[model samples]
Target: MRNVSINQLDDTPRKVVALGTDYSHGHLLPFHTHRRAQLLYGATGVMQVRTSDGNWVVPPQRAVWIPPGVAHEVLMLGVSTRSLYIEPGAVDLGQRCQVISVSPLMRHLLMEAVAAPLMYDRVGRDGALFDLLLHELTRSEVLPLHIPMPAEGKLLSLCQTFLNKPNAHQSPQYWAEQIHISLRTFNRLFRQQTGLSFRQWRQQACVVLALARLAEGEAVTRIALDFGYESPAAFSTMFRRVLGQAPSVWLEAAK
Candidate 1:
């Protein structure tokens, strides 16, 4: 396979590469990881990034950060898109493991930043813009599209289903029994496979459910109860922790 040339750098230290492509239809990027952090965005249409921790759906305003060495893959959605791939080490703005929004200004700057010649020196306008872009990117909001997984493939699938049915009161051990495994076995398999405790995996499920419910126009209070939260305030507290904003505020902003 040909490595897509991102960018080229020369002189006075490390280099950064930015590569992009306009692709259409059902494009699938196989599972892989790299030394450079990847900031993937869609100028148009929707995209999804699948990492071991979860599946993050990319809205038009959002982008996914695949930190260095995280094995993952891409699934394209909607129409063709201009996928801007920033080279690693060029910018340390994006954090690991989150799907942040691409601000209007940041998006515009990145459109230009990616095109900046690799060999451009640090003193150039491109370098200055690149650095600024990094700062804005870090300040951007992370869209809610991540779905954490359990280690067992079945467990992971069940997690997705749980998100779709957050109101289900049945315990995972109940599921284990259905899957013909003891409760202990089910929990052990999930921990080994998903690299997270069962409780952590469930937390991810709750977040996904919250996002989906929000996307579907469900009220937070109802969603909280539906997700088995003790109260709306508790649910809102959890949401703020995971998404860095309260539900009422974020939902209004979403509008």
Candidate 2:
């Protein structure tokens, strides 16, 4: 689905432009760039965004702040999204994409902003609402919901393979053997290429893949088993450790 409607979006002369749109399950947006920074949040379901820098997953109650001029594509996992387009320099949300948590109040504000006129008054109640929205965005807490891929072709290929079938049971030694490298050399290369140790990267890959599977209506038990977790509790512990909530609870919030 063409949810963002960039053709209809006119960011000029407006500090903040909001749009509320829905996407069907598995909808994909081709790589594109926006002149304005985008705060793309899902009211329900999950969003997977891939940029040159890394891949980010935005779950429910969270949003990804994509800087202006960055080429990115989003895969909507059955989500209804609320998007805010801010003119370049209107907000200093850094120079890269980062996932940020959304407060209950901020969620309400976004809904209200999208319902307001395209060109909201800058001196009236609408102006104050948008102002508050911007403030909340600036203070939003960043979340660890990204997986960085290595630039090296060999390492990138290996990383992509692991991401496709992430399993918690795999050890660094196993991965090193898969790449036909000594354990010591594998450790050095992984750090140099991905900026993360093999263990760290595996866990991150598992978490990222877990988010996608959960969004597709898979049960936590099945997902845990698929990811090589010994038990549902073990999987929930890892999920909670990374996301600060159990998988079931997180899925409930997304709904």
Top model by TM-score, which number?
2
lDDT tens digits, residue span 84-167, model 2: 888888888899899998988999999888888866689999999999999999889888788988876767887778777777
How many residue pairs clash in model 1? 4
- In angstroms, how far off is 200's CA in candidate 1? 9.7
The global C-alpha lDDT for each of the candidates, from Candidate 1 onward, is 0.65, 0.85
Model 2 clash pairs are none
TM-score of each: 0.62, 0.92
Worst window of 10 by summed lDDT in candidate 1: 1-10
Mark the regions of model 1 whose C-alpha exceeds 4 Å error after superposition. 1-4, 7-15, 79-96, 160-176, 179-255
Best by lDDT: 2
* lDDT tens per residue, model 1, 112-200: 76566655567788777767776786687665566656545666677767766764355767779767899889888877776666666
